[model samples]
Target chain A: MGLNLEFMLSIIPELLSAMVITLQISILAVLLGIMGGLVVGSFRVIGPKWLKMLIQLLVDYIRGTPQIVHILIIYFALPRIGIILNAYWTGVVALTIIATGYEVEIVRTAIESIDKGQIEAGLAIGLLKRQILIFVLLPQAIRRIIPPLTNELTNIVKASAFLSVIAVNELTKISNKIIYETFYFFEVLILTALIYTVIITLLGMLSNFIEKRMFSTNSEANS
Target chain B: MDISFMIEIVPRLLRATWVTLQVSAISLMIGLVFGIVLGVLRVYGNRFIVWCTKGFVIVARGTPAAIQIYAAFFLLPRLGIRLPLFAVGVVALTFNTSGYQVEIVRAALESIDKGQIEAGLAIGLTRWKTMLYITLPQAVKRMMGPMTNEFANLIKASSALMLISLYELTKSGHAIIAATFKYAEVLVLVALFYFVLVQSLCKLSAYLENNVFNFGKTADPRNEFLN
Candidate 1:
């Protein structure tokens, strides 16, 4: 009851295996979210007027609501429409949707952050619009977006814990399981939080390092 | 998808929405006060205090908001302290909000021109007076946009209080879902309620950034982390 350091250490292996699930889901969501964000983000920028409005509404809905509500809706509502997914996939879908929402904005903002002259310069060089986006705009935009994209990545990792609400065997859910069995809420939850903090802190450091490197080289190129 | 059931549940959901607003409003106010202190400390406090502030922000932002709420709800009672469910919700949320708010304040304060602070000191103003008169006025204007986004983020996050069995809007939706087995309609309505609340905050943020705080300059769209 005082502090179960021994028990906390004992459960770490279990928690770590669950952490793998967390990593898997996060990595998967990041990939899909980035891809979806790139497509949807580009469409919002270059697509026709009506499609832009549609995508904007979708983005706003995803941004406005909570991730927990998203998971719950995907869990409960999908079956009514004949689209049944398990807890894990439901989590992926929800996290991806959330990530893509913010990522679209990141992408759009990053793309827009590039000066208008860059696009015109590409046109003057005889590059097609698609070619300009890929060979010209995106390479530059990727550098600018690294910070926000990394922030979104960390958010997806943290948000993965919400999947526990739907009985996914992730870190938080496993910690909840241990707490129920042993009532070591303090030790277990603290350790669980440490795992997340350590991961995210490292991520933050990495983002800073990358941003520094990218900008320094960018300035060097400018010079 | 029972239209009638969804319509009927609106009043019940609205009552719960009131709880959500109460919880978030209390937490946001508390968070703003603490956030300003911590933000200033991170900028101007001693080494120890700055390290402590950084550590707190990392932990608060790093962990899932739900876990923080769970710690308050589940761990406190284990430690032989008792509080009402509403207090727990607000305490957990304020902790979460203050974490992000610290970064916002820190950024805004850091953005103030160092020359102006020195200029104030050169003209015989004390450090606190310089900060109070010169730095804070400018920082407050910059803080408004990010702070509004944080408020919306807090409101959306308050929905996590349902995990602790706090009877807020989400719990209200769950109740209706259980009784009627109309998951889609009820949950959609629930999401819509949250959407409306958060969107209004978003609109207010835009208005402040563009009209109130613009000063004829194009607004910067850099604050994406909160959304």
Candidate 2:
């Protein structure tokens, strides 16, 4: 089949509109995931024994299962418990749940990587556990976590494609819609991939820049 | 809410577990074969082949597997190449895993010391013979841990099969949930199945770490830097 430049150009605007929804879902999910990760990560490390085990189990389950299945469970199953969310919210919630699981491990590892002496120093200074966690542990942990956290964000962006399965009108879903309408499957898919590649590439570059800056600064301070 | 309904669904889900295992096992085997070949090619092949292999790895690694499955399911049929849902899932996953596994296997091969290859050559072995006899055996040993992790990853990733309408474990759980509307209960069970599978793999990794990959015991200075 001959390429339809005009048709493709016209669909660009619709696809661009859908990109907004995709970005919105990714960004919101990442934010919720990061927040959830902090809570769960801290709980896993420093919370009560039972809570730590529960959070650890949650993280394992999330990491072990596929995002699509998690989405299906959240979207379809939640309604049985009287929690009826729209597709977009369902997508975000489910993605957040999965993301949080992975992110907790990232955060917990970051926290663990912080020098134990620093925590001891905080205790030596008469800082309470809460103060030490809030001021000292979190800052260092967050700094160490920037790289992995960025990676998790990129993963969430790619994973947001699963939202399309539930008809959330994200970029991939929109591309599917266009393909269904125009019957230009290759063009639509290639275009969709290009969009994703561009966005993810930019995010990757930005994260690398930040990682270098942080590490170099840290090294300079240490030296 | 109904325990009896979940109990009724268990037999069906257990039967569907066979499909999940089949897809994971077949895809893992195919992916490992392709991964090792591509990985070795990337290391030992000429420049053009290396570039082509790199390109394959990059594209496969860069995109989501779900999109790959969707593309395969929808696009291949347009070219009069119709693959069954299970075939599509396995092929998509094999392609996906090959990309990542190429890097893993390549890294393991590269980690082997150069002197071993030269020693084999000194013994009058041809390059290919030396590679097969000297390099691969050591590389395979080094790859044991990573390969185990990759197998676990394959099991987890096979959950993507559900998106393509393959009635794997996750899909089976969704099927049960559809009838019983016990989303939380069914998902928890599904999650437990995944946990048991992955945790067993993790235990296997730990065992390999302790018993086989004895670098842990040596306290080699490399461990300090690596840790």
Candidate 3:
């Protein structure tokens, strides 16, 4: 059968409402990811050799495997270890873990991107290491991190769709349910895909704008 | 928790890993061909052609791979073009891979020095000839690192196929868990399989970077470990 535009239009409200859950889970993950990433990523750079190595192994394990497996581990396997989480919490934990892994890398690189000369200047001015880190390094690093951090938001949004596998009732899950009932596969899916495209494309544009502004201001400050 | 159950599923898990690798490899190979064409068109085609390629990339990238897989699984039957689930997964995965690969290829192509193309033209090589003989060879080298990243991404993204019950690595884990309810044991093995597979690809790419593509240029530090 042909696409039913009327049927597709009818489901928009339901799908849009479910979009809230998608955003909620993604935002939670991104928030947790930033905080966790900042803490762990800093340790990765400046902590003891053992901490660095430990973080290395964590990053390798998380990055090397698929997120689906992580979901299974957190949602399914963790119960065996006596830690239980519902599907929503499981989705959040899984996405946060994924986000934090990348965020850790981003933070580490952002911190590294700060010019050593800047640190030396802080020292030349008699600033303590802590002061240099807090006053000089982090300020610059935060500016550098924002663009990639914004990019990561889009990644988290896309990753949230995986929650559908666990019946998380997010936008994709809602759409899948509708498709099953209506048999309007093309219409429902195309609309769902459109919603995702709009969300991601907007986030991507914002990232580009921020990158341009950050770099331009950076050059101006340097000059 | 069941050590014996985990041991029992090793053979089946290994077979599923084979499926995972096969799907990823086949999709990536096909994707490379389409990506090259789209990347070329994006770089050199008329406005209409460029717009089409850009639109394809946007939709392919913007939507989730799971949605794409579902669309393939569900919509293909309506067109009277039904395929097995395995083929459907590959179709969807290839479509997804080409979108990302197009960007890699485009970036590689654009990074080629303009002067070289001009020199080729000055020596009477057509624009197409220059692209074929000079630009492509150099671009191919530059694309290798990013392409390696894309393949790793494809392998991970292919896990979305588990949603379609394609009996890939992750799906196999789900199957075993269903049969035995030993989620912990089955999934650890599945994750371990994917971990080793992706790590080996990363290591292989590193070796290629060091030995073959060694221009003495360092790789991007940000992507060094993250990808």
The true-structure Cα RMSD of candidate 2 reads 3.8
Candidate 1: residue pairs that collide: none
The segments of candidate 3 whose C-alpha lies over 4 angstroms from its true place after superposition are A78-83, A124-130, A220-223, B217-227
Candidate 1 residue A142 Cα shift, in angstroms, is 2.9
Model 1's chain B TM-score? Answer: 0.93
Candidate 2 lDDT over residue span B1-227, tens digit each: 56776677778777777787788789888988998899899999999999999878767776777777777877778778887888888888888789888998899889999999999999999988888889998898888888788888888778777777799998888777677667877877787677788878877876786687775564221111001
List, residue by residue over B1-227, the lDDT tens digit for candidate 3: 68887888899999998999899999999999999999999998899999999999999999989889999999899889979888999999999999999999999999999999999999999989999999999999988877887889999999999988999999988988888887777877888898898888887777677678995765544232210
Model 2: per-residue lDDT, tens digit, A1-223? 5667777787888989998898899889988989999988877777766777788767767877667778877887778779998999999999889889888988887777777777888889999777877898888788778887778887898889888878898998888888888788878877787787777777877889989988888873222
Candidate 1 residue-wise lDDT, B1-227, digit = tens: 68887888899999999999999999999999999999989998899999999999989999999889989998778768899999999989999999999999999999998999999999999988998899988998999999999989998898888788899998888877888788888898999999999989999998898898885765644322111
Docking quality level of the chain pair in candidate 2: acceptable
Residue B146, model 3, lDDT: 77
lDDT of 3 at B126: 95
User: Ranking by DockQ, best first?
Assistant: 3, 1, 2
| lDDT score, candidate 3, position B98 | 94
Residue B19 error, candidate 3, Å: 0.3
Ranking by lDDT: 1, 3, 2
- Provide DockQ values for all models, in the order shown: 0.58, 0.41, 0.63
Q: DockQ of candidate 1?
A: 0.58
